[model samples]
Target: MSQDQSDKGTSLSLEQILAQAEQDQSVETDYQSGFVAVIGRPNVGKSTIMNEMLGQKLSITSHKPQTTRHRIHGIHTTAEHQIVYVDTPGMHLGGKKSINDYMNRTANSAFADVDVILFVVEAGRWTKEDNAVAKKLQNTEQPILLIVNKVDKFANKEELFPFIEEIAKEVEFTALVPISAYKKINLPAVEQEILKFLPKQNAIFPEDYVTDRSTRFLAAEIIREKLMRTLGDEVPYGATVEIEQFMFDEDEGRWIIHALILVERPGQKQIVIGKGGQVIKKIGTQARKDLNNLLDARVHLELWVKVKENWSDDARALASLGYNDNYSS
Candidate 1:
């Protein structure tokens, strides 16, 4: 999806919604705020949904499954509510490796702590993975908003009625809506449902903040997203982008970010670097443009590809790659 996908939803600001709410002075509306977990199986457009909601790309996304490794928080604050959206790794049916266990742990941990969960799934496609997530939801009484994403991909609009009816029988959902996260369809409806469930309380984060992640983290994620889109399925498993150094120049008024792209082996590194370093160069250029827009300042991005043998399987290696347990907490 384009970086401007968020713009599609921002035609009406949250404040405008709050202004309408404030009109009724007799109602005495207490401020609402809470955490919401966006959970689903891999490649279900969870990140795409949240990024569009915030009108900024805080999370990295690609066609590849398991693209989101950390439980990232995108904060949307207003006089009415502050919704801290948690984008977790897609829960999968695997545990042979430490990374798989780490992803499952990161995703499942959010359910217990959040006020609402967006159980996302693709339109007209229900796999065993979706069934696994629904089966787990049966144990919890938390308010779940069943999000059937990618409705635009369907050949006919009528295809959604049966899809909605079939999936509704699988679980008890608080609300159900079919949306195209990529096309910015029905996002406001989802946002309204989310606000309806949030508890009445003061805001947890500052009003200006859109995400809990730093600019450096966003840089690395942008680079990884470009690599995923560029390399396609040829990209190796367990590849990650880590920012080595992030600093701003006081004299030049620009941000300089040094990133290390970690791959499983030398052969995979060769694929990422490409002949004459063309692939990595392309990734850096694309990432730099997003950084410029995200920070609203000049950016100089330095990228390096390195081999880390089986880093995903080793706990210490995962920590070194910035997958530490504290990152999400």
Candidate 2:
């Protein structure tokens, strides 16, 4: 037996493994493909669940609410099913700005024709935001899988049963599964539940594809994530990231990315730039490392903090920042 086979929990022979691999390469008769929307209020781990399902870090994560402000599509392909997970911004009822209105519309628009919905909430706790999310998602015919996230943080495991029961009373969830999206607990079960609703069809995308976003978009998001993590409360609610330039040199096997960190005020810019440029340098370093890993090429990143006042409230400003969602739902 080969070392790979020995490491695997299965004791099948090499011929059997190869045969299975060949058989599982791509079968169209029973193949499945559909979209699954991960929706919930902010900080409830909706992005975390999408990342775990796709086994890639495409969406940004931060302790601050509203970290995800757009709809991101992350794809997961396997032998039997291809699940296109749509990670939407947290649906909230708190703001009146155009940006907030855009975010709310973007999230609600994802429910048009999805095969399944993952309504994620923190384990053993319920808040008004949760009620609001449930209310918004009401009257949908599609099946919803209630994903109770952060189960590892719960003090007692027994609370999960009653909690699931309590949440079930609010909406007719097809099923409820407690999982820690951060720790990847019970992920296979979650995957199985979603696959039950997928239609029998061929893959919608190339087998090796992972996402619809380009490298420039991902790089800008990486920088914003670092800024959100490092600055925390200092990062303004209207903060937005834009890629000024992204260039690649085939001969040099390198990439050059120039990005602008847009803030609403001078003080926020000062905080982002930091004293003696330490904070900006740290953000560039972390973002470069991730960019290099993502592209498998050396990245030279340049960051600049610029002031863009009240862009969140202006309609034209939101469009210029690429907040439009023209998905063919």
Candidate 3:
């Protein structure tokens, strides 16, 4: 086995290691790699920008505010560089009992160890909330890039200049990039700015690898995304998906996945199930389709709804839900 594979603790089946070595040898001699954290308020298109940067849906995104709860890293490798982009939860003003407070802390924590911070903003308006967030970015030691997303809505460049100036006055940004994350305008410029900030380090992840998250975690996230999209308001925010069992039968070429949709209360459970299991059935069908596409095989997905009262507040439940004090800022 190659040294790299061994370091990853993978006892690759001889054939795999040789194939990987051949691919590794073909990589460019001089390569740069680093991490960039994307931070902004809810619904500013941070996830959308990360997805566009990687040229794939590495992060789950939706129209609802604060869709991303955790810090998800998407690695983009080129012949010259490997950029591990971290998509963080949105930063906003928080209340003592509010989950939004928790999310804001998560977003700010990404700035601690990253090389660059991409501060995304909505193109149309700059609210007082936007100014407050910009002020926080000014205090960060790392290089900050002001990215004005949703610029496609603007009719001309002149219309965007005022908002751009307002942000620039607040923070000493490394670069101010106006791009539409949805429409993918001026994305090449964003990529160029990312390269400039990246450290001169060897590639941390193998060229073929895209993310650090497991297939199961991503599957659960996709299900959560569907829940966030289809189920309106509080249902999506208050819910979490946990995979109880995931067994892949190599000989049979099938995957058996049993997951529990955990909610805070019985009333929320009823909403998820809907009238006669209609909503959950729809959730299952959509989730299965996504699973099949991601796994490249048939998936026998079994979903069960369980009410765990105050799962967010319970320490053990928070740990099980993938939230720990270590993740807190």
Candidate 4:
């Protein structure tokens, strides 16, 4: 057996791996490829915008603020160009936990070494968090594309002009485009703006690869998303998911996954499990549906809840749960 099977954890033979590598290296000379960092404050539709651009959901999103805890890359490739969209955790000011620090550091680091920066903000809603993000972008050298998302909420397009002008004063952007990522309104314009700054180079990742993260990492996120969506405000923020076992069962012809949900306190664990285990069951059902879609195969998912006190605050525990700076697949 090879030392590395596959980054996505699919059991591919050496020949298949070599064939994919050959395809990845055969990009045309005129191909335009570069990184575009999607950044903003929490729940400002940054992840939604990237998903709209890529026509797929690579980042786990929820209505809750600070739902995205890590930086994820969603890759889009075409005959003409390849755009790697870096979806980061929403930059915020508060929260002194270790995970919060990790997320903020990850978002800050993404600003460097990127071809363009997509500074996303809600259409009619602007806050101090948005101002903080703008201040950080002022020092960046890359072309900042100010993306005003959720314009569909406004009935009158003319109302957006004043709002756009207000943001213009705060962010020194190369271009400004208003879009509704949720409604899929004018997402192409956002892509067009990104292409204007994308460099003429070869593809960074394999065309077949949609993301830099492993299937294991994605599985954990999917499970985490369900927890975020289903649980209450307090418990979800205190919770994190860890994949203990992720492997394919050849005899059964399905993927088997075991996940451990860590919480800060014993009461939180009980809350996650719910009365008669109903809550956990519902979360599992919802997560399994998404997991099947993500893996494109049948999945047998097992979920368990445990109390790991203050894991989010503990630096070592945070790293063990995949909150580290080095997010190597």
After superposition, candidate 4 runs with Cα above 4 Å error = 1-6, 9-28
* Deviation in Å, model 4, residue 119 alpha carbon: 0.4
| Cα lDDT tens digits for candidate 1, 1-329 | 22333222234444453354345334545988788999999999999999998887789888888888888889888777889999999999865888898999898888876899999999889998898898889877789999989888877888688877877788889998789999999999999999899887666565765765555566778888888888967554558888887777778777888998999888889999999999999999998998888767788889998888888899998887777665521
* Model 1 RMSD, rounded to 1 decimal: 6.6
Residue 176 CA error for candidate 4 (Å)? 1.0
Q: Each model's number of backbone clashes? A: 0, 0, 0, 0
Candidate 4, residues 77-96: lDDT per residue as tens digits? 99999898899999998889
Q: Which stretches of model 3 miss by more than 4 angstroms?
A: 1-29, 98-101, 325-329
* Best model number under lDDT: 4
Looking at candidate 4, what is the lDDT of residue 295?
70
Give lDDT: candidate 1, residue 26: 40
lDDT of 1 at 130: 94
List model 2 lDDT by residue over 56-84, tens digit each.
Answer: 78899988988998888788988987898
lDDT of 2 at 155: 78
Over 242-284, each residue of candidate 3 has an lDDT whose tens digit, in order, gives 8888777677767888989999989999999999999998999
- RMSD of every candidate to native, in Å, equals 6.6, 8.6, 5.8, 4.2
